[model samples]
Target: MGPAQKPNVCRQLSRRALGFFSRDAGVVQRTNLGILRALVCQESTKFKNVWTTHSKSPIAYERGRIYFDNYRCCVSSVASEPRKLYEMPKCSKSEKIEDALLWECPVGEILPNPSDYKSSLIALTAHNWLFRISATTGKVLEKIYLASYCKFRYLSWDTPQEVIAVKSAQNKGSVLARQAGIQQPVLLYLAVFHVLPFSLIGILEINKKIFGNVTDATLSHGILIVMYSSGLVRLYSFQAITEQFMQQKLDLGCACRWGGTAGTVGEAPFGIPCNIKITDTPPLLFEVSSLENAFQIGGHPWHYIITPNKKKQKGVFHICALKDNSLNENLPTVTASGRVVKRTFNLLDDDPEQETFKIVDYEDELGLLSVVAVTQIDAEGKAHLDFHCNEYGTLLKSIPLVESWDVTYSHEVYFDRDLVLHIEQKPSRVFSCYVYQMVCDPGEEETTNRSCEKETNLNIILNSDNHSSDC
Candidate 1:
């Protein structure tokens, strides 16, 4: 067979060979062929919108249900179609008394119960109230007040009994603090709590004088990474923090100071200069940082900092691989292998005015051995979902996500198998859930039509030349 016909002939041979093999062997051969076909046709991938739903609050998807907070917090089943499963009771006016505790605030974050992920969920509200609610019945099983008037920015659950950590900031010039004549800067609080029984563990009060304002924080594999506005990044040992928490159990009311003795493993400057012009209202001080439990590269950890340049309309991802040097020291010292910068779009020939880009969300799935999946939005309000190779940050694949731009709304996205769950939060206390199905687009029909037309034209040209020769 010729080079162009070899593929077809080989496919025919494979099908015939499959009939000769046993049923189990045929199944294996078919699976291998499917993988081969996918490798050969990687660029044909496309995404289709499957379903969309509207809500009054931010939505969280777990398994087959979508959880959100509204007048009454509720969970909706989205197995086949979106339908309300259950709604929690609304807080009565009498129950809204000053002394009364209520879990009626808009939920800022929703996390699955680590022990019972399927049936229960833990929700943190905008008012710093944490509640463990039943996923099926929407019943408030337990709730705890973290801190009053504390603006929480980050929430994460960590190992060693799955302790939850919440990062919040309280302005010193607030009503209570100002009345007390406290002239210090904004106090950053990292509250640790247990969800099983819903009890406060201990709060880590970050020293602004030493660490500066915390821009971002994440916990992974017993390691706590805290990034500051001063361009400083610090790593802490969660085990050491737990030990200190145990020691200060009697004085849990008083916040424990961070650093010095509280699990200061290693510290480093982010190294990248903060020169980007942020376009957010009030202007953010620093770029967002993400820490991944990257054990693929020599079993070491990796973290990334995405800096958005509004003027240039680009996102510069600073990737650093952390090496464990704990054997020499008592605690693990995180040393970066090197920093790699990956730009979202090509700067050499790309026009900034045409498309302004911002990274809304990105995830690093270390377990799946897949590289980072980034969700980027353009100025025209289109979501560009792409995956990049882990080592050099090369483009792997782009899955088109359909979206419209609304300045009054914000977005969050989650990827699971072949489904993409996009949640958009609006200004008037509403959110929208959009689910997309990822599939391969076969362009064989167009290719076949074009090939047939070309062959017919060529045959006619040859026949006319032969007629002229005969004449």
Candidate 2:
């Protein structure tokens, strides 16, 4: 492979590859068909032929449907078996799809089922419109316009009385008069909508002062958890909104019990005010005086508040169980106020230079938390990665990866099944993905321990990130 012969060699390889696939022979046909079924061939303008290229877009899997975006501005779905279903048109000629989510109502835990509602729906939010499409047919079932007042930052699906969750992004802004002490206005508004009719139920304007800036909000098991930038979390009752949607007919005479306007037959319905004030003062979950603003909330049922202590450079993970709602199973319960300190722990204390570590991203699957962290950098301009496994502080496996300074990583975790998929790419436009089946059974410990040695060989395979050019 001399420099001068490289181009000629690649040209020959490409022709042979095409000729091999173009064959109509028995073996060739079977091989080609099997490959096609194993992976999708996506066409994009950036690359002339993306048949063999792996997409960098996020892959979403729900109820057997696999959703991903083709760089050409189309969001498409297929079965997990890699069969194409539908490719939605760009949100508009000018706008690309911002986000797409698949949600099933009657997610029987958070809210009761609506009388008229039946199955799940695909939510595609683009520009200023939210389109509810049928999951099976990929046809637009309904379209709802998000008003100018409520900026849609994220969309979360609640478990109806059947359950799943999805995410979307939406925004809010106001004109500010410049002055010495003037600050740009920031507000958190909760917009409720009827999923079946695809109409706005109401928009609840939350007081900004209540909790500095809303960092994240999620609705689960009928309780709405709001996290703030200051590490303050507040729980609000979603019953008010759930109760109204359950009714077969609208109650216009029912004034908002939360001090908002009412909902009409048409327009934003605020008829049943959210009883956000379930208590005179809602229970405050956390008040980290020394906490910086880089925290994230994860975990189901029990909320895992993860943040790094900049001073120590170690990550702090706080686990708070949702308030015991066993007695009041009607709505999601909030964790009592005094349990934050007792439940908190340091993520990885054994690492010598844990302070230099950064928690890039993590996923909880197969009863273990897979945390991808960039270990302390070495002097050779190369970096290492440690897949820190934490079953709530009990470390399971810490697999170290090959040293590489500037590699990009994308991953997908399947909740329905116990499988982890990771794609790593280097600056040379080379990509490699690995599917690791998480085996944590005590009976399989002997076999699993032997597999750890093979991980070193896998890391060596990753070193050859450079690939031969197809053209």
Candidate 3:
């Protein structure tokens, strides 16, 4: 059979989960053959609306159509669809690719750069490479390759720092290694790179053996907060990391052990840039930094410490804001140096099913806070989503989600100050995006606004050609 005739599990699972698969064995084989025939007949690949918002206007990629809101299109005067706006790397026959079977389209995010020239500066990531592309002229500004076989995580564009932080790890072949009882090496690496000119500023091989494997990483202020598998959390200075590389003290090949026991780097804990172990609890998931308060010493940022409500507060998130002052050596106990806020989230009063809920995404604007919480689907396969005020803990809207036609929490929710976008992948391998415009009450000072209007809806379909198969 040809490469296009392969039986893919992703497509098969999507079909089976949606109950679109045929039961007859002969019919299924014939259907697969028909799909392969269609793949062979196609000449070129076409991508549907891959969109990103800029200010109030949302730009549809590939087609280059812009939508101001749900009612009107930006350049609606033209009769036909807009032409392709950007160009991406294409595969050639002469190229001997290492990961021919396992590949994904580069996921792009529009960076928030306050510049006149950068109207289209976007960060794109594939398997183990990051690309800086210009959406205006379809030009690739810079490309950096991480490792041959690795999975990416903790990817964020830090606007203030003007750098993009990405965490990668060695993907030991199959993703089912742990389930198959195969031991894989603990290899997690964090790389911070320049966004504009696209240079590799700093690279650090996280010491998984000493600090345990990294569960997640986040960028707050100029600090890189890393959480490990053992539930131990540490902080490192982003400025210091790039400075080391700029001064030629650390190389790309050198593995820096920044957070071991005392004297690991021949410096006192206070002398080191960021050498604080904030937590020892194993299952705590680190969230974003909530508030920043300035005092006599300096301004310190407080981040949310999130733990699943599995114990005492079931079906709730035991979230608390904590300020870590472990950088000061005068503080004897690092964990005790943390100042935690007493607030927690138990939004629902009568959730008897003990459904798992999480603060998937959130935004704060003009003394008003908004959060999107996703609860696990019930016995009828209905997922519950709550959008509300984080401070008041009052539910603004409870949206029931099903699999067939509506949006799913399986995807991430992207938001700005006034809009929230829900992008989900359908069983047909298409992406459906729903954008919501938020409106606040001008009369009420204490009560948070709960009214929201549907702004726009977009669907993205990937058309596969012979060169690049289904993405």
Candidate 4:
């Protein structure tokens, strides 16, 4: 069948309208309305607010501890009180840092130590500085300068000892270079760092002018998948990239050198060619039509790419499965199979320009994926947590989050099994916790028995009251 004629496997109701029904009621009604008896008997599940906290700075939760921007707080479920574990030292003003404190730093990403998350954490600032802080004492253990004129946006742990960082595609320097007749290739910098000793392993630069601007990149199952604005998706062997960077680091005798040079020759002289090799094996490439946003659920073999249908105000999801044997080799050349299926869902609130959607969590057993839909109305920030069945794109539930008008700050949501934790910043920080639990409705027989018992109790109460009045 042609693409246009294919039926929509999943259709969702309007968010505002769906809020009226019970959570599971909406799912059952939409999926199988013909089974009226089953729908009436099935119990509904909903999220209940468990606890909330207010923090002076941004917060992240892992295990049982709540990690603030500069310190770690130990919080227990039974008690909402937070005991401060450590506090990091303030940044020196002599350094001319944009934000003196780590929590308030601009364009920063913080991650826990993969080897020992409870002992240490890592923070990457927009100024290209990486800081490793002790979680127990809040002391800066190690710090390294990555690169100048480079702005990093994302960080992922490749291994317990290694971390990978990617540069922002909307970097001002690259944008200006493209417009100023200096076609410097707009290099996409990917830096690898060693966590324990705290050293830069090496840098991998991709020529964006040759390919296209990077829209999204992720590391999964030892493969690096990068999606470009030109509808190109390429999978590279992350192990191969790391091996090349290690070799270059050994040859140059410095962490930041390129092609046996003393400094980063690639960035020092703009457009200057460097002999640093990226990878010996060619990357597996897939050209997707109208590809805009793409991401993979960790530990899953499926890669999802979204294409916006502006005319209909919908987003189409193209689910593709990865080959089983592709990532087994030393120099992995991963390839995606043919498109498995296409699922369509409405754009956030049916407005193409006002809202954005991002996949936040995926439940493997239930085959459900959670998406955070953020919409800005009249400069006020509003968001909803949407759960959708991955196979059919059926929206199971939509829960509205607390509203915040602070557009400058972004909100964070973390899903932990049946519990969800969210952090938001308006002027200060607020942490909220929700638990998904079953709300059982009495069965027909149980309901009848309860009604009889209540009637008998009412008669006894009436008789007692009448006797007391007469006396």
Which stretches of model 2 miss by more than 4 angstroms?
1-52, 56-64, 70-82, 93-95, 105-121, 160-186, 194-201, 209-228, 238-420, 423-471
Candidate 4 collision pairs: none
User: Whole-model lDDT, candidate 1?
Assistant: 0.47
Ranking by TM-score: 1, 4, 2, 3
Output the lDDT of residue 349, model 4.
Answer: 65
Cα deviation of 264, candidate 1, in Å: 32
Q: What is the lDDT of residue 185 in candidate 3?
A: 41
Judged by lDDT against the true structure, how good is candidate 3?
Answer: 0.39
Q: What TM-score does prediction 1 earn?
A: 0.50
Two-way lDDT contest, 2 vs 4, winner: 4
Q: What is every candidate's alpha-carbon RMSD to the true fold? A: 18.2, 16.6, 21.4, 17.1
Model 4 misplaced regions, further than 4 Å: 1-57, 69-78, 92-119, 159-163, 166-171, 174-179, 194-201, 212-221, 239-247, 251-285, 295-313, 320-420, 425-471
- Location of the lowest summed lDDT over 10 successive residues in candidate 2: 41-50
On the 0 to 100 scale, the lDDT of residue 435 in model 4 is 23
Ranking 2 against 3 by lDDT, winner: 2
* Superior candidate under lDDT, 3 versus 4: 4
Error of 1 at 392 (Å): 13
Q: Per-residue lDDT for 423 in model 4?
A: 62
Cα misplacement distance, residue 68 of candidate 3 (Å): 18
Candidate 4, residue 6: lDDT: 22
The estimated TM-scores of all candidates read 0.50, 0.47, 0.43, 0.50
